[model samples]
Target: MEVICLEDAAFYTLIETVVERIKEKLSTTEDKWIGGEEAMRKLRITSKTTLQKLRDEGKIRFSQPEKKIILYDVDSINEYLEEHAKERF
Candidate 1:
């Protein structure tokens, strides 16, 4: 086995490159969780209250893993849109 050594600057560049690659991979992965703000944007709503009401009424599914942050399942949001879509015939 051979040992490879890097100088200070080289080591930092390697670390930075690794970090960037990891970020790219994560960002490109299938995002299954949609944050509250993103969901509102997708639904063209301007208020979190509207989303909260839907959550409270069980009209939409959501998860609050933390005290202040909520995430909705992308599939559920898509289903809600389909259910509420207007037909143009």
Candidate 2:
């Protein structure tokens, strides 16, 4: 095995680069809004009624800009899932 050492400035620069790359990856994975079908898929539900119920009960955040067009907030859905997440031993 070979050991390589980095200088203080070089180590800091490497850390900053890794952090920026992680942030870029996370930002790309995040979504501000999604359609009902995509939201349902993310939540692993198949019924439209279940999705509507969640919206009706305010369990999730959504917006209806027109008579039939609705958009779900991705952040709210993630929050809901996190709130219901179970602890593992």
Q: Which tens-of-lDDT digit does each residue in 1-89 have in candidate 2?
A: 99989999999999999999999988786568899999999899999999999999999999998889999999999999999999999
- TM-score for each predicted model, relative to the true structure: 0.64, 0.67
Q: Show pairs that collide, candidate 1.
A: none
Task: Flag regions of model 1 displaced more than 4 Å.
Answer: 1-30
Model 2: ten consecutive residues of lowest lDDT? 24-33
**Model 2: colliding residue pairs:** none
**Residue range 40-88, candidate 1, lDDT tens digits:** 9878899889988888888778889999889988788889899999999
